[model samples]
Target: MTTPQALVLGIVQALTEFLPVSSSAHLVIMQDYLGFKNPLLLFDVILHAATLGALLVYFRKDIGKIILSLVRLKEKSDEEMLNRKIFYFILVGTIPTLALGLVLNQWIKAMFTSVTFTSLMLLVTGALLWISKRRADSERGIEEMKTTDAFLIGIMQGVAIIPGISRSGATMSTGLLRGIKKELAFRYSFLLSIPAIIGALGLQLREALLEQTLPSHPFPWIGGVLAAAIIGYISLVLFRKIILRKKLHIFAYYCWTIGTISLIIRLAT
Candidate 1:
């Protein structure tokens, strides 16, 4: 690939990594557009690691507080108690997704081969967000939540592994449907992305190392990782504000518009 092609791929990965759109789905579409095959999966791992670093850096202070409180849960200290509860909620919320992912990771990738499937799944995401926004109360906070609620949200995350199903979008929709306020729901969604991405990248990284056949130049790889990290951080903060104040119903509109147009273009061409 030309340096220009590599640069474009980097930009696409950066932009879609945090947007409600599925990054891998867009990457696959764009790769098909360019007629590129045998993509260096190492690059995929690098981009993912960069985005994970961005999240950890962005949430550093909150992560620290959560960690300390979780450690002090043995005392059952009153103030520490709430934070510990949230900590447990996160763990419980991650389990279903992780377990399901382990069971079906290979099969799920096969189902993603059809562009139409991806395009249709994008519509599903839009519909889900639309229904969730309208149906949700948007007033409840974390304290009101139960363990069963968190586990149910985890199942929602598991279903989001389909191509074009936005991981953050699905988790947030689950939280909203469970009566959590938009901002806190968005916060938990972002928090959950950390663990999901880490597990995925680790698995992919191992595969890439063992199976990589082509070697990529160091400079483009470095450039892509750096740009993805900065862009991912900006996307998180910007979209987060949008999620909190505005109705996410509009994002559904965008997704449907884009997905429908893409499907039409593909059929026509």
Candidate 2:
């Protein structure tokens, strides 16, 4: 990809990744519109790595606490105990997500090829988000979260592997329906994504290496990564504010509008 194309893809990936919109769907749509025959696997991996870095940087304090709590196992403080439990909760959540991803990997890849299917899924995502908006506000925080809640949320995350099904939307909606506070739902949804993204990055890297699809000059793509990281951090911050403000339902309309238009265009063409 040229520098301009890389930058465009980077911006799309960054914004959609955290905006309760499907990044994979947007990338597929962008590539189709740009007439790219195949995705640049190496470039895609790099973009994801950049967003993963952004997640780490944004949640560094929480991650640090988790790490410290694990290392100093003897600490019986409530905060340490909470951090340690959260670490276990993440692991539990990852289980169903990884399993579903593995089982549906091939099917999900096929889904990426059909814009009609993706557009339809976008409608589904919108409905899910709208449902989340109707849920009465609850005060359940991470300290009150249970393993069942994590597992259920993870199942939704796994299902969101399909194009147009937003992972953040699915997981966060699940958290909300389970009565988790909006802030914790938002925070936990992204936190759970850490393992999912890492697993995906690992698989994509292996595929890129085996296919020898690495760009002849990767330096140009570095700009894409930087753009993604910067925009991704900002997106995360903005999304947090939106969710907290109970305006997440607004995206439902955006998704529905886009989905309807895209579906019509795909059908007409």
Question: Best-fitting candidate, measured by lDDT?
Answer: 2
Per-residue lDDT over 1-269 for candidate 2, one digit per residue giving the tens place of the 0 to 100 score: 78888889999999999998788888888888878877666777889999999999999999999999999999999999989888998999999999999999989877877789998999999999999877748679878899999999999999999999999999998998999999889878898999899999999899877766667887668878999999999999999999999888789998898889889998999
Off by over 4 Å in 2: none
Tens-digit per-residue lDDT, 1-269, candidate 1: 56666667777777777767777667666766777665557777777788889889988977888899867767677657767777788899889989988887997767555567777788888888787867455787777888887888788778777877877777777788888888778777777777888888889888888877444567766777778888889888888877877566667887787678767766777
**Scored by CA lDDT, what does every candidate get?**
0.77, 0.89
Highest TM-score among the candidates is held by which one? 2
Candidate 2: worst 10 consecutive residues by lDDT? 211-220
RMSD per prediction, one decimal? Answer: 2.0, 1.2
Q: What does the lDDT come to for candidate 2?
A: 0.89
